[model samples]
Target: MNNQHETPEQKRERLRQEELKKNPIGTLKDGFNGNGNLADLVGSLGWKGTGILIVVLIVGYVFYKLFF
Candidate 1:
């Protein structure tokens, strides 16, 4: 709990755990910024979520191209 007392490895692990608790939007931003692995993010979403996301993206792209 005390950063000053933590060894480098402990500090790194604490930070890693904190990063893992980020919300989906934060994770998405981190992925876009290249600070996080997108594969990990997609893996967290699982197949159902991944499928829905893809469908939504395709529909949005089609709608955008059709309207604007």
Candidate 2:
């Protein structure tokens, strides 16, 4: 609870846990490791997957434009 009282190992573990919480979808971690580009990431999922992703994005964009 108290950073000043935490040993170095405890602090490191706490920070790691916090990092995982911040990136539950692993997107941030993937980006940090250099696969940040959305197209590249989606391409890795194959044609069907890419198609699904594109459709989802387009639908989302349309909804956003219409609503906002």
Candidate 3:
């Protein structure tokens, strides 16, 4: 077995190549679509919906504090 240490530039290049493999089109395409329409399939009971719920809660709390 042999151990090798990569220079900073070499390590960065390797990481960039790995990122390209994971997202060739950059951020335009959603890679997780292989499973299906994640939103419809998983329903609205997920982090997406939960995030909206949290925003609403925060706004409501602010309004309550401001008005009453």
Candidate 4:
């Protein structure tokens, strides 16, 4: 595809992919530092939804432990 035909979002994503390949360790660091959508979703969920998610995770872990 030609750069001239690329949309703005497509250009940004292509650049991001190139940068990711050049600095994967930086990507991992950013992910661990919660510079991603998971953190945003958790924050947007508010305390009640966050608590419910934690409870569900705990239950899933217990089930995994029991079965595996």
Candidate 5:
């Protein structure tokens, strides 16, 4: 039996395997699934929600300026 250390090619193959194990692409695909739902929720809100958000922001700014 040969108890030799790994060659350079073997080391590179091992490194590649380790990298794939650590960061699989499937996990990335799973991570972004919520973004689609968030987009759909925002789209359903329409302009009325946007207008309310703007008004709230303006009121918040006014309050901040008055208080500080």
Candidate 6:
């Protein structure tokens, strides 16, 4: 085992290289291409629906407090 200490910049650059390798396109789009229907794409992801549900619940609670 080896204990190597790297500077902050060095560590950042190393992580950047790893991410570039994972995403060669070098963009934050998550590899989704254009021309695809936005609703279909979002609906395909289960977590997105759950997140929207949570937001709706929070807003409903806030509105309830404001009105009642």
Q: What TM-score does each of the candidates earn?
A: 0.51, 0.43, 0.35, 0.53, 0.38, 0.34
Q: Considering TM-score, where higher is better, how would the candidates rank from best to worst? A: 4, 1, 2, 5, 3, 6
- Tens digits of per-residue lDDT, candidate 4, 1-68, equal 89999999999988876766677566655755778555444544557877998999999999999999
The C-alpha stretches of model 1 lying farther than 4 A from their native spots are 1-34
Candidate 6 backbone collisions, by pair: none
Residue 6 in candidate 2, Cα distance off native in Å: 52
* Local accuracy by lDDT, each model: 0.74, 0.68, 0.55, 0.73, 0.57, 0.58
lDDT of 5 by residue, 11-57 (tens): 87666556446664533343345533433333334468657867998
Report residue 63 deviation for candidate 6 (angstroms). 0.1
Better of 2 and 6 by lDDT: 2
Error of 5 at 66 (Å): 0.5
> Superposing all C-alpha atoms, what RMSD in Å does each candidate have to the true structure?
6.4, 12.2, 11.8, 10.2, 15.3, 12.3
TM-score of 5: 0.38
Output the TM-score of candidate 1: 0.51
Candidate 2, poorest ten consecutive residues by summed lDDT: 37-46
Best by lDDT: 1
lDDT of 2 by residue, 2-63 (tens): 89999999998787557556663575447447856653355345478668878999999999
Better of 1 and 6 by TM-score: 1
Ranking by lDDT: 1, 4, 2, 6, 5, 3
In candidate 5, the residue pairs with backbone N, CA or C atoms under 3 Å apart (3 or more residues apart, or in different chains) clash, namely: none
What does candidate 1's lDDT look like per residue over 1-68, in tens digits? 77789999998877665665666567666766788786656754658878998999999999999999
User: Per-residue lDDT for 15 in model 4?
Assistant: 83
